[model samples]
Target: MEDIHALIQKLDWDTSEAEQAEAIHKLQDIQDEELRLLLQPLGKEYWDGAAEVIVKLGYPSVKPILPGLLEWIQDMNWPGAGRIAPLLREIGDPLIPYIQDVFRNHSQDEEWMYWIFEMIIDYWDKDQIVQIQEELIRLTEGKIIALKALRTLWVHQIYSGESVLLLLEDKMQRSLTEIAQLEIAYPGIDCEALGRGFSEAIFTPELSRAYIEEHREEFNFCHRKSTLHDFVSEIEELVSECMGSGNAPA
Candidate 1:
């Protein structure tokens, strides 16, 4: 193990590709904490090798290393952080709290953070939805990330109407003009089509109401069977139920 650690320490990224590969292969066999401690300083350049070694060491062995790995991710400049998605996926639910912290605290790093959220969404417990929604709302704010998060929540139907109503109200007031302009700027496509696309993309049902309200004349004559008020009523009902449940709306 000491010899293996020495070899890992001596490995140069500038070295020939063959030498790096050979070092990684040998490093995989060293399961001692002393060896891991020695190799920990290699940073992201060694992530591929480290991940391989950690995974091969099995979950029990790798469990001890997660906290350190998670701490490394908090460093914006950490090279090994980029490999976190795969590592967390490899580690599975045991890493959920760590990933959630990243999502909550790293609002500016939405691109990377979203992948972490995406990974954990599948395993989210129902009770966790309120917190997840709050995090999503806080992180996304006015950005496209909010839209994506909403879509994810919508697909899962995780939020009650009350939570959704808050989001709907926010979107109605904030994004109405932006969406209307999108319709006006692109005259060939009707508002319903745009609403459908928005609904599909953001998973917000209120977008449909906003679309109809903005273009009432265009859609009213074409679809006489259903009124915009009906949709609004449905949304309100959902919102009431969500609020009554006392869950924080996402």
Candidate 2:
């Protein structure tokens, strides 16, 4: 552990790229939290190395660092936002609140907010649908990012197609066509699958159900159903099959 700590201390963010890469690889072998924490300050200059450290530590080891990482999002000077986003992305829903809070507050620096919003729409508590709706309104604000966010929400069913259609009622035809085109162009590669998989692997059904209920509007849209009831029925059948098959939940 001391040797690991020494290696972390010796990590030079300004080092040659080869040296930095070597430090990152060496850091991946250390498992102690105190040692990990000792290396936390390195995140500022060695963002990639920090990310590798976090991933090496995994969730339990990294959990302690979350609050600090969340606080780092607001650090104007830290390039931690971009580096942290991928780590949080790797951590997935277990880190949802931290990600959501960043989006909720409109933390736009580093585009971390956008990344967080994308992750939440993909994997957060379905009950957060209302929050997602609010976020869509707040962050998107009619820009290209918003359009992209909206498309993400639509794909994940974070907002029901009806809700989105209603929101864009003024441009329904155009938006719907755009959404369909975007869906095919991008396919099912958004946060939804990741969220569902995380939910099944780490969360309870009740929690999963809450996520579903919160995002029923979006789910309804995915099924091409006009009503929530139809969507719910389909979800039940899917859930049953998933559980019976011993597949990863999603």
Candidate 3:
């Protein structure tokens, strides 16, 4: 544990690159139960560098870290499932079942569920990603467990290049608008950040118009395109060009 302490003391963004790499390398070598123990609390905002130490330990580290992450979620510990999802993703596809089970068990915690979706984008293969898009669409079409689900689907649809507006109802549209206006720490997630595309996807002209139409007197619809159906058509064309002639995603 002294090694863990010494190595962690060296892990700072301000440190020299060589120092950072050396600390990470040494942390990776620990490769034991103690390393996993460090992962539990380190998964949070401050001690995340320690989490990276376990991440550097890679697949072998997965088995030990995962159970603790899930337990924290199940027990509603601080930071909870939302913080752990991306950390879990660092170990990749092996944790799919654990992630899936969380949705089944704690489906009502919406933001955490969406974080899980974002994590899959970095880890899962293309086919698995397709399945995620479909499942998210299905989830959005039904009674939502968390309002954030629509926003999650909205971003997935941007990449899927699918017509999200057509699949969604008025309520889902409102949910999307709410998230568009929500204060999020963009490029903030661990493993991989949400990126600029997510911001643009949520504020698409079509969704903006829907919000304006719903609350006509609330605000000006400055985002409205010259054609009422303009953004939808652009998205369709984009889908066709990107995916080729076939309606199915390539």
Candidate 4:
């Protein structure tokens, strides 16, 4: 086996372009499994440069790296930990079967399921997205992960992100006398995401109320029990104002 110590060292972010080129060349000479090793980075917290090199190498760099990623993702916090999502996007549709399995297996792990869905989003057509959504919805029925899947449905334009966020609005609510707590009913739930749904203005009140009313008893809602009249009035005002604004973009 060729020694990779120097080559890995040269791939550091601080290295010159020519040095990086040489390191990349040496990386290309390494076997696929070893190439996957190079992704560890020349130094700690150096994912940017390492990810760039991996992503730039295109399909070859990503293929062998994926199985490990499929496992690593289980422990990862997406949109925060690393650039792996972009790298996975470079891997693309060819890894569809693998990702589907990841989502299927980790349906209860909300963040992992979210990122895996994101990595594979662009690859699936609307029809495929719908199929996947229905399957996940069934597997995750009445759980927090079902709300997470709603985010993906919004991304595919099959549902509005706001509408999905609205579905979680009740979870974010609390009466003045009461404190909000994570819904104990659903394990591994992501309450902050539900909070983000409103803080970010990604909510459609009418849509949220319809869902809340439909599943009033079954939803793992963590909010204080507010009066039905109050909820109705809130949705009505939102709908009236929105209609006046020509159904303002959700």
Candidate 5:
């Protein structure tokens, strides 16, 4: 055990890459019992170096310690926490059940859920990630985690955009654009109300040229008409692309 600890200590970020590789190779060579025993220290503390070796060792090697690793990273701000994703990604489909467990049990932890989306979920395939799409959509109903879940869906292209908008738009009156504008808007009658009204008018149901033209007087931009026209055209084009690829409701 002392020898395992010494080897793990040698895996530190401060160590030379060559030396870290050497330590990893040595750890890999250890007998199965010793290797399994070494993993027991994981998530018990911030042993940053140990993560890389586990990623290299892969799969069943870390199965016993998987739950602890998940819990340990709930802090999200831990140094070298980024390395944990590669290990989890390497574990691949085997990590799905545990991820579902986290979503099921820890859905209330917005930051933890956000961390899972930002750092971990993107590395997975759409099929693997879709298992949690329902949960992700459910989280969007909450004020705090909505943006994070929406982003995970949008950025990953996890669902057809129309499907996502349909699933969420009625349940959530504010479009992502409207929500973002309101969230960042200064708290005042002029600034807040204009942002709210403008975003809702432009984004609700569909963002189209006809809609923008019909509500043109409501657009209070200081820019020239051409600029506003161009902006509206761009948004219209983007929505068209999303709807084109989406799986529409039957």
Candidate 6:
């Protein structure tokens, strides 16, 4: 363990790229279950190096250590914590099940779940991400992590906006409140992400028209009243264009 810790120290962020590469090479040379176990505890102390070694080991070789790695990264302040994101992304689809487990077991740990989503969720392939649609929707109820889920859905173009609205109305309501709180927490931060998400999720003429009609009062009540009303107007115009052309609502 002491020897492994020394190797990980050599991979610290302050080390030169060449030096880190050399350390990575040395660690990769001795990959095995024992070495992998020794590397786990060092994740907090030497994550920069430990994560690189795990990334190189790849797939099934590193699969058993994933839950531990997930736990290790809960502390964003840890050394080389940023590297853990890429490592999870490199592990790719194989990491999804473990992430789903985190969602199940740690549903109350919104901060940890939010960090996990921020670090790796957007980086995963769309096919892999869709595996957790239910969990993602559930996460929309989270005070800290809802924005991450909403952004992932918007970016990936998963589900119809109306469907997302119907299935996740209560949760989306909470997510909107969370977004407002986030704007307060970080003044001048871009809150238009919510608007963009709404646009992407509810683009169809029927869905847009129905949503505006049903939720117009809610939009009027929003803190950013003018911005949301403008969004509703855009949707209404799309509805009018479709109707003028004699296209049935879809």
**Best by the lDDT measure:** 6
TM-score of each: 0.49, 0.45, 0.45, 0.52, 0.54, 0.55
Model 4 local distance difference test score: 0.54
lDDT of 1 by residue, 1-250 (tens): 4476556644555657777667666766665464346334665455555544554555656676766665544443555455544555566667756656766676677655655555545456555655566676565454445655654465456644445567867754554455455556555645457556556645565766676577666654334323334434444555454566564444
Local lDDT at 25 for model 6: 80
Q: What is candidate 5's lDDT per residue for 1-250, written digit by digit as tens?
A: 3387677767666778898778878887655556544442445342565666666677787677676666646765675566776676667677777878887788878677667766678666777767778877777666545645655676567655665556444434343454446435522334345455567766565655555575454443322333434434444444454566553311
- The reply for model 5, stretches above 4 Å from the true place, is 9-22, 29-46, 147-160, 166-250
Better of 5 and 6 by lDDT: 6
Per-residue lDDT of model 4, residues 1-250, tens digit only: 3477666776666789898777666566566657666455545434445555565566755677776666544545422135556666555556667767767665667667665655556455666666566565554344345544554565566655455446445433422222223234344544445545444443777766665565444444433323333444454444444445443323
Q: How far is candidate 1 from the true structure (C-alpha RMSD, Å)?
A: 12.7
lDDT of 5 at 2: 33
Over 14-121, each residue of candidate 2 has an lDDT whose tens digit, in order, gives: 677777666767766665556435334655565546655666556666776675665544443465455555555566556656655666665455355544455334
Error of 6 at 220 (Å): 30
Off by over 4 Å in 1: 3-5, 10-22, 29-45, 67-84, 118-134, 137-142, 160-169, 172-250
* Candidate 1 whole-model C-alpha lDDT, 0 to 1: 0.56
Candidate 6 lDDT over 3-70, as tens digits, reads 65576778666788898788788776554555555344433545667777877776667666777777
Better of 3 and 5 by TM-score: 5
1-250 per-residue lDDT for model 3 (tens digits): 3367667666655667788677777776675656554544432542445556655565655576675554543423344344455556565656666666666666676655655655544445554555455445445544433223444543334333244334433544554454445324222222112223334445688865564465442222222311223434443444444346332333
How well does model 3 score by local distance difference test? Answer: 0.49
- Candidate 4 residues lying further than 4 Å off, grouped into runs, are 14-17, 41-46, 70-83, 118-124, 139-144, 151-250
Q: Where is model 3 more than 4 Å wrong at Cα?
A: 12-21, 40-48, 67-92, 121-123, 126-250
Q: Please report, as a residue range, the 10-residue window in candidate 5 with the lowest summed lDDT.
A: 220-229
| Candidate 4 clash pair list | none
